[model samples]
Target: MSNIKIFSGSSHQDLSQKVAEHLGLELGKVVTKKFSNKETCVEIGESVRGEDVYIIQSGCGEINDNLMELLIMISACKIASASRVTAVIPCFPYARQDKKDKKSASRAPISAKLVANMLSVSGADHIITMDLHASQIQGFFDIPVDNLYAEPAVLQWIKEHVPDWKASIIVSPDAGGTERVTSITDCLNVEFALIHKVRKKANEIDRMVLVGDVKDRVAILIDDMADTCGTICHAADKLISAGANKVYAILTHGIFSGPAISRINNACFEAIVVTNSIPQEKNVKQSTKIQVIDISMFLAEAIRRTHNGESVSYLFNHVPL
Candidate 1:
């Protein structure tokens, strides 16, 4: 691990430190600051020439600045002749804009692809991220991209916390997440359900209908992320109205942007489970319904395996508990 150097940006320093500690190493020193004009400046404190360099920066608070800092750091490492540079972004930025749905009418740009291009152009040799909003976003990058899953850790949490797990039903808030919910239910040998939503306009959900039985059973909603929490809260209300004994939610990234915390606090869910893939301290502190699970150890293991040229496919199914 001597040749492996890990540096962190300002977005999520706590998570980076934990990941470094899990690998039995200290974080590499780097000076990062914003100028008077709010421009990012990065200076590597140590020589990274001929060494594997991993920059830990999640696209969360101050998203633009964090992203710019990561790109600049990658360029600096490459300029210094580092052997390789990997952007270890726990929560990728602009992941939701993975497609150009409306071309002529709105000129929708695939921002996810744009970010991928920026990273590549900025001297990133590899990418590491977890539970991307859209899995196909991996295809946007020409270089090697490791898309890790947070399901193993989430499943482990469910197994230990949820009583009578066999009686609970895994639910997908929308048709798009059916595959993700299926994966979790299959692992637990449990039944699963799906919620079909009808939208009147952009970001305005008209109604939601459940496709399976949740009556008298615990309903666990699973998704990749929750930004505004509007859909999640509405789904939880529907589950409760449908006579579900209890409602819970598990998502990889707890963006909790805008009014997400307020909505979640007033929602019917007993607990809103999420991984610390994004900095959620404020969200957790503000809401009694929020529960955060650390995924640093899992990420650390993936980094170790990747650095050692070992296969990380097994990590997809097993949590490193």
Candidate 2:
């Protein structure tokens, strides 16, 4: 642990601080600023020479600037003779842009791949991120990438907090999340349902068709990310309309941009749980239904194990209590 030096980018210093606290280490010093023209600059305050350097940055608010900051920070650490530099991006930027939108008949860049390429080019020896929008983004990187799951944390929260977890039915807000719902359902030995959504336009749902039974059960919506909360808020209503006794949501990355706060506040969700992959202080304050689960333990342990050359698979199943 002494050989490790963890730094943080501006995107999510709160989460980074928690990770540092869990590891019983102080965060490394680094100054990040912008030039008059808005270019990002980074200066490492202390030497990271011959140490395992981990820079904690999330792909959230002000994403482009944060991404550039991470790239520069990683490059700086490597240039300073750090043994290895890992970018611990809690929520990966441009993850939703992994592939081209087929049937749109227009050209679009695979921005996720572009981000991966940029990371490798920026001297990141390894990558650590959670709940990628598409799993294949791991293949986009040439370096060793650890795509950690928030499943155990979610499980812990449910088992400890939800009194009627036994009466709960896991639900996917959209077809893309069916696999996530299924995995959790299998773990809890519970029934799961899926919601098929028809989109009229970007970030707009035309209609959602609920499949399977949620009647009289506590329907828990599971999703990887919720940017505008449109899908989640609508899915909660659908669950209620399908005769669900109660509706809850669990998302790994709660980007919660635009009207997400107001929608959640006005929606029918008993609660919307999200990991601290991105800071939720403001969102939680604004919406009484929002709950944040601490995932810094898993992240801190991952960093420790990686530095010690130990396995990180145990985190996939063991509930972080």
lDDT by residue for model 2 (179-276), tens: 88899999999999999999988899999999999999999889999999999888888889889999989999999999988898899988899999
Q: Candidate 1 — worst ten consecutive residues by lDDT sum?
A: 100-109
Task: Encode model 1's per-residue lDDT on 1-321: one tens digit a residue.
Answer: 779899999899999999999999999999998889988889999999999999999999989888999999999999999999999999999998988675345688889999999999999999989998899999999999999999898888899999978899999999999889999998999999999998776567999998999999999999999988888899999899888999999999998988899899888888999999898888888999999989898789889998999998878888875
Least accurate stretch of 10 residues (summed lDDT) in model 2? 312-321
Off-target runs (Cα >4 Å) in candidate 2 are none
Which ranges in model 1 have alpha carbons more than 4 Å from their true place? 103-106
Residue 194: error of model 1 in Å? Answer: 0.8
In model 2, residue pairs whose N, Cα or C atoms come closer than 3 Å (at least 3 residues apart or on different chains), thus clashing, are none
lDDT of 1: 0.92
